[model samples]
Target: MSTTPRDRIGLVLSGDVLEIGPGSRPFTVAPGANVQYADRAVEGGRDQNWPELIGQPAGVQAHYDLNLDTDGLAPFRSGSLDGVVASHVLEHVANPLEVIAEFGRALRFGGKLLLVVPDRHQTFDAPRRATPFSTVLTKHREKTTEVDEASIRDFCQAIYGQPPIHPTEVREWHNPAMLDADRLALHRRRSIHVHVWSPEEFASLIVCSLLEGITAWRLESMYFSDHFPARTADEFALVLEKVPFANPNELGRQFVDAWCNSVLDDTAIDPVRLARFEEALRRDCADAAINSLPLQLFAAKHAALGMASTQDRITSLEVELKTTQIRAAEAIAQGKALELSTSWKVTAPLRALRRLFR
Candidate 1:
């Protein structure tokens, strides 16, 4: 429905709008008053998405806050807000389902939410397995409120970006315990992109939630990377609309009827060409894995040898430190003995006289 990225963003938002976690670059500008909660920068400065040193974007207010997005706009009366906006916010939250529910609470029926998320395959998140729908439902059932250790580990694992990078097999030895400690430290920073999905994967979350009557939002419009062919932008923007009377009975039908007239252009992707692309990708990956294993094993051996050399250097430094401490202790004892002598007492007076003269 929209030709440009900016147009797609503007399509879903209008009137008195509330944008969540518009950290440093909010694209939406409404005719009515706009309010945005500037999210705390992820402190470690590792991830580029939510950075620590970035200056606050225009119209970003620190006062408009949530303890976390889980407490989403409880004070607003039902059917009060015209629109809600969140970009790259859902993945980091502990409970995304609750975040959506809270946003839906304040939005008037027919109000839209503009959600933009990273296309995992295009970002550093390429290595992560797509989160199963069941995992999302599980979090909703348990009412999860804290980021887990497992999530942090996946975020830490280095992944290449789009334009496939040839695998470089470099082996570095890291203690699993130390790595665990590191992951814990990064998690405390709270700037983790915990969930990842392509546009299609995210659509499932919205559609499935509506089907189960868990949420009142339905997919209205979307924009993917193809929309911007001149440049590379990994985020896929979603426009979701909230419908009225969101209960088990009417919610499912409301979602279904809204899409009754939907027509899909199957010609967009030629199935035979798509199949050839998939097969070629799989074949190349399998061949790379087979070729890399031998080199990887030798690299591990080389890394172990390097670790042994470092250990020997550490032991030599420890022995040198012990010898220096012994010599220093002996010198201190000699000075104490000299202070007790009659000659030293006479010298002490001479030293005091010299100090006064100086």
Candidate 2:
């Protein structure tokens, strides 16, 4: 029998599953299945009816105070959960990979991890650049705690930075007069969209993270929606499977090698485009390698060469300056000589006689 998106998701989600940030519109799992909801703020708290309060659909009531931003879903036992659903919740978190690893830790072997995040190009974040995978890696490695300030600024500035042209646009600019400290505190306390990504790039991030030992979740299936009939689709969904290999070193290497090979596989089908792609990759790889050099080391190597060029530039400038000074002096001397010449003497006497008559 054909199943709906909810049905498809529910099929694999059974037995001790958890859903993160299931605001007012939680995914339909089973009629009376054991599904625990988690969120930072729930109804009747300081941020009472928080999700609904913010004009969002408040899904299931939060039974656990699990915060994915600072406190990941790490309280759960390793390999204890059957599934995890984090729908449209990752973009608000500070460290995506940390939570991702926690998801893997919570799920049993072959358990499912459902994730959904906004597509920057299709959402209110259209004005911003996609978060680079390299930056993602750095944040993940560092276990970043605070919201990326730049991302918060970008978010606030993009939607509310400019004056509204139409009724549908933003109503007011984001606290233009507020101090930096106040602004950061507000964003930190509230939900902030921290990362932006395309579906393909997001998928690649998951895969690359696994390949690089940054995370243990394996991509199972992925989907992108344009939210058709609407201007843009806001979110992309993906599924991950938990693996239990003690040493994934070989597995990770194989995955990366196969992926690289697959990138080249397109050449057989689309030689023209593939050729250009390959050439671009070569150029980019070389640039990346050169750019990876230590800043100080690179500077030290080039210091002597730079000094030599600077000396040559100074010498060239001195010659030009001398030539200009000489020309100026010669012109001044010519002017002086002309002032005392016969033509000047005759003109000066005639001028004096005319002035006296006036």
Candidate 3:
């Protein structure tokens, strides 16, 4: 149906809309117009699909597996949608660049691509280092679909050391399930944070991607959360505008080159450092039996129960101490009152006479 003024409340909500990983509450731009919530699954059965994060169903128009969809938004005809919103969903995908490119492909010219990505510095991924654009490009160029052992080990090492208080659907990591040799299989079964980034790194990544012909989405506005969210805030939001790239101008070339250089300059990884990281991962992965779920869960429960019992004991002791003090005070007051009584002085003379007669 054609969008009318009554259908769209705002200027941006004029046509078809697609929200990837909308979870429970989807972003609604056009109230009466077609809006689709594209999720990996309806139920939280998929390993990577966090039904909890997305929450329960909320009138979601459509559901599809992002893993099987493979092409990201390519299944949708080019220039079909007016906008796409993927909130904190890109970190879980194996190929974020492809997903971003698909966003550009799916939306019509001037359409918006709104992305919310978690900052590693703020979330449980704090232990992890930001993923470089070169690494991302390699995965994209290699067309790697499934995660490898190295990624599994890296993720296990980072998350196990510092688990997210509110983890996405990948809750299995709360225990030692992530350290097992079969972790690669587990990762394949579910989604995990395959990449990490700060807001600056993310912006530079996008810029580099643009220079590499990954997408035509131009950066319109970027926001880094502050104050209430803090520097370690859970995530940052970005808005990109889909535009045609007929020819590259001098200004555009200079802009992309400068950003790319800045991003790449710091990304020159040291081989020795990387080897050390891998060695550390190996050490962590080797201790899978210790990190197993049942053992960890039992330990947590035991700790909690122990603390509760200790508190109860302390409270009992406090009550006993107060009662003892009250009894001692009462005895002292009774003795003082008897000594001051007039009857006690008269009874003392009679007691002396009785003693003399005896």
- Alpha carbon lDDT of each predicted model: 0.61, 0.64, 0.61
Which is better, 1 or 2, measured by lDDT?
2
**Residues 1-358, model 3: lDDT tens digits:** 5343211222254477777777655654645656667776524363334444454455454555565227576568999888888877889888888778878888899988878788777777888877877787888898777666666677777766664554554555435554565556655556678888876667657655655556766555444444222243466666677888643232234333333332223323112222222232233222442132133333443454356568999999999999999998999998889878998877988999999999
The TM-scores of all predictions, comma-separated, are: 0.61, 0.63, 0.59
Candidate 2: segments with Cα more than 4 A from true spot: 1-7, 30-32, 42-58, 162-173, 176-179, 226-232, 245-358
Model 1, residue 286: distance off in Å is 32
Ranking of all candidate structures by their lDDT, best first: 2, 3, 1
Where does model 1 exceed 4 Å of error? 1-3, 38-59, 159-177, 180-185, 246-358
Candidate 2, residues 168-263, lDDT tens digits: the string is: 312332444542876566666666788887664565566456545667655555444532334334676767778765434444443333333333
Q: How far is candidate 1 from the true structure (C-alpha RMSD, Å)?
A: 24.8
Error of 1 at 33 (Å): 4.3
TM-score of 2: 0.63
Q: What lDDT score is found at residue 64 in candidate 3?
A: 51
Q: After TM-score superposition, what is the CA distance of residue 253 in candidate 2 from its true location, in Å?
A: 8.0
